[model samples]
Target chain A: MSDHVVSRRRLLRTGLGTIAASTVAGCKVLDGLSAPDHRLRHFMERANDLTMAMQRGVLDRDALAQEFAPVDIRQPQRPNGVTDPQDADYVAHRNARFANYRLEVGGLVHRPLSLSLADLRQMPTRRQITRHDCVEGWSCIAEWAGVPLWHVLDRAMVHTSARYVLFHCFDTIERSLSGAIRYYETIDLVDARHPQTLLAWGMNGAPLPVPNGAPLRVRVERQLGYKMAKYVRAIELVDDFSGIGRGRGGYWEDRGYEWYAGI
Target chain B: MSRNTPPGPLVRRHTRVTRVTHWIWALSLFFLLLTGLQIFNAHPVLYWGDQSGFGFDNTVLRIGAVDDRGVVELFGWRAGGMGVLGYSGGAVRAFPPWATIPSGTDLATGRVIHFFFAWVFVVTLLVWAVGALLSGHLVRDLVMDRHHWRGLARDVRDHVRGRFRHAARYGPLQRLSYGLVLFVLFPMMILTGLAMSPGVNAALPWLSEGLGGRQSARTLHFVLAAGLLGFFVVHMVMVVLAGPLNEMRAIVTGWYRADAQEAGDV
Candidate 1:
């Protein structure tokens, strides 16, 4: 009977030994799970790619996000990230009511042009109420009125070499000894030209609030809220975003958020 | 391991599919729970509607730390989730660092780990469903009948008395709990999770609508996770009560000790 108990203890000892061995080895493995270029992180990034591919392939590219009624726009759209910009230039533009503001369209475009806020408001417009899903497991529904993003890109005639559209914002999301990093975002042509992609200038029938991107923001309806670059001042077409902020394609992406937040 | 050949006190209690999926579940759930906590700490509050932000009263739960002070509010009830939740070490994040992946406040890393395991969990669950159907394990073992209900009282009494018997394959309460986990809890977790995805909502609008919007789905997901944790705690206690070695060996090696009369009867 005692020997039987002894055997069980031996089994436990062996089990503990295996766990100890794994922990010793797994310390490095687990600690590096989020580190860039590590094996576990490699798999995680690969999984992110898988998620993006599966969503892109399985779902219709132009499927519209659920649109709620006007009554569904409860309370107000919750502003997030850099809600207010203290940048001297942005303050001057705000002070001037953005009368001199120009939406600069450059990079891989056959006809690089800069248009005033009035010029953009004159383009093709669409209004829809959609939910804003934040990366932090919260959501807000709001009615947005804006010109279709494709209209502007079409006017500029994005060059065939262009593969992605980058949005430059007026808000500085971060600043330190490394200097101020203004907000920016990138989207593939598919999403950039999606029928619902809008350069929104108004929210809930009013001019966009200072807290909610003010003059303009890009609304990529099919993605998380971060994809919508707020406080927009410029749009650039590019074949690659490798030369942009930290080369991750967006301000948040550079800080470790996934570039593709469709989920 | 054949049904009829091993005519002694040893019986094959777990099939290969069951054992493999069980381990997969154990590993995935561990990471899912911890990493899930990490994600939760990012917002640290849950609401029950389509929208949530400042100046609203829809908050169902909130946890935070202020000036090294930790607090938790559920509905209107308040408590200090000092060490394990709101505050840990010097961090003022929800759910302590020890409970999170990366052991620091890294939402991006937590998200990556969460999504990877989420895919693993999803694919494995699909594979398990098909495999379970083909193997008769779902029907033969998991399905409960009048016979199972009849033994409920006796099984309850035996468990309370610490008098385990090898009278039947599984106890009625055990089957019920396991059935709920397999058929109900897990499915709800997946559905709620999918509902929170804006991408999925475009494809499956009815899912979020049925669940009362995306934020509601997030709320349900957290509640369901809590249910799973409850089930795990009860499961562990039962394992210890019924005999840990025998249970562990049954799951790990598919071999469990049974009484002489019960042997070869299965």
Candidate 2:
């Protein structure tokens, strides 16, 4: 028999055996479709990159997320992720009404500074009724008032080498024997500088509620809810994110969510 | 007509582009539907208007479970069907494991696969449309004229009676159905999908707003999927009724062997 020749009996046996094995495993057989090193998964990730690039290229970088009229802000913003994080630092800050709280700004910046809540409130501000799109497919519209992130970045004198802005939050979304992991998120400079991107201090004309990130949160309006890190404690500018959580740029991203949540 | 007559000489039916894109669409739709259900399992409620939360009241559909009961509420009407929707095989999930890709609550994986095939769907549609137009395949085969509909009543009457006019050219009814699906439903699905995207909404705010709301657009997407599923079922029945082997050969090999005497009219 030639090296390339296949016997009919052998082919039938192999095909039947494979079918029987698949039947035995049942649904778990599809687990390999999402396995880390699966070839199909690589294609999917590559397609994600293509989608990201296409969106980035096609959409005007400055185009603002849809802002609704006051009448449209019918409901209070729904709180997601960790509400009332029990971190001691956060509790103390809450106890004092965030009076002594300071949002630390550092990393790849010319000026590193820690500013009080009052400092953020005093910056040039914008109030817009915007829809909060959740990754789970529900949406909520609410009014958010805050200083554009660019203003804070300019004040900190972000370095020219910086490519991404990371938001370090006080809330821990996952806890395990290894230790609690605080939620964090990252956005590119384009989104960081977008007009609607806010380091929000207020919601629906009221002081930010503890249930809704309290004193402050970063809102990347063009992205999904997870991209907007709540309980934002510090901001860091970075050129590379590979050293961050699982190197995927956000807490949820580390667990296989898309880093670019725009879509 | 004689019962024992052989099929006539094979004739080229589906163009290479048509055959290739058709299979690609079949594969993409298969993956997209399964993964899409998985994503829906994340939040299985459908509402109207721009928002959904504690404040929104227009709960059009809600698939959920309690203890051992699975509940599926649609437009205020409710039903219980375990092992299908809501409760499935000892767990609480909107859609059963067998119906979803990864067959679990892996929204992350579901999202990855859904979006991956979604792009494939979009790209293939563009290629198929542009090629069909350039090759005149759209005009010569899929498009219908007044003359094609002249025998419409007879065609439907025959179809309902298990009789078929398995011709080389598409019947007026077939063209109508395909037209509705390819031109209307497909575009609606793509647009509805985009309307739900916050990024696309930024660039085309009117897309979601004009659809009444983002949530409404989501509902429409689901409804349209059901429509596509209906079409697939009817399409399969027609394929089987019209002669599976000939239909399969037409698609797979670009040649169909059918009785020339029967198919000669069209």
Q: Largest DockQ belongs to which candidate?
A: 2
Show the colliding residue pairs in model 2: none
Q: Which stretches of candidate 1 lie over 4 Å from their true place?
A: A1-9, A16-29, B1-8
User: What local lDDT score does residue A150 receive in model 1, on the 0 to 100 scale?
Assistant: 93
Candidate 2 structure quality by residue, lDDT tens digits, B1-266: 11224567676678888999998898788778888898889999998888885675788899999786899999889899655788988988999888888887898888888898899999999999999999888888777777767877877887787776555777778888988998999999999999998888998889998887999999999999999999999999888777765687688778776565754643
lDDT of each: 0.85, 0.86
Residue pairs clashing, model 1: none
- DockQ (C-alpha based) per candidate is 0.63, 0.67
lDDT per residue as tens, model 1, B42-97: 89899887777556688899998767888999997999885777888876888876
Candidate 2 C-alpha error for residue A119, in Å = 0.5
TM-score of 1: 0.93
Reference-based lDDT, residue A161, model 2: 98
